[model samples]
Target: MVVDEQFRLHPESTAYLDAVRGMGRSVNTERNYAYGLALYLTWCDERAFSWSDPGFENLLRLRNWLVSTPLPVRGRRVQPVIRYRKDG
Candidate 1:
């Protein structure tokens, strides 16, 4: 089991990560989830928001930020665009 410093500081997050591993999830999947959670915590810290109890508005803001944030890949960066469709 790999222990990340940030996860150590956030016990709840560490427990969640441990649960993910206990579920027989792949190491890569676990790592990805950990990285994602770390990013969320960082975002919350930047805004002095409570990561454990983020309100709906804050969640929406986080979603918007995620959409606009570019991810690095293969020495290049790519921004993910999400499109919503209206359906009956």
Candidate 2:
């Protein structure tokens, strides 16, 4: 079981990660998706939530969180810039 700085450990997670890599997933892709899943699980634990919850909202929230993480490219963290004007 590999525990990163985030302190998440699951041997099953390791097997899943290895399976993806064995199937020719890029190292970065495996790393990112695995880390994201671990983070999501941790979030669920903190909130006392379960994957069995019959709701799509939680899944949507996870997708949103993934998009919100800055993507590293060309030695930089880049994200699509969005701006909204406050109307009073």
Candidate that would win on lDDT: 1
Clashing pairs in 1: none
TM-score of 1: 0.73
Segments in model 1 whose C-alpha atoms lie over 4 Å from true places: 1-8, 76-88
lDDT of 2 by residue, 4-75 (tens): 577666777778888998999898999887876777667666667774472688777766655675443433
The TM-scores, one per candidate, come to 0.73, 0.51
Over the stretch 1-88, how does candidate 1's per-residue lDDT look in tens digits?
2234554467788889999999999999999999888888889988998988999999988888777765544433375454432222
| RMSD, every candidate, angstroms | 5.4, 6.9
Worst 10 contiguous positions by lDDT, candidate 2: 79-88
lDDT of 2: 0.66
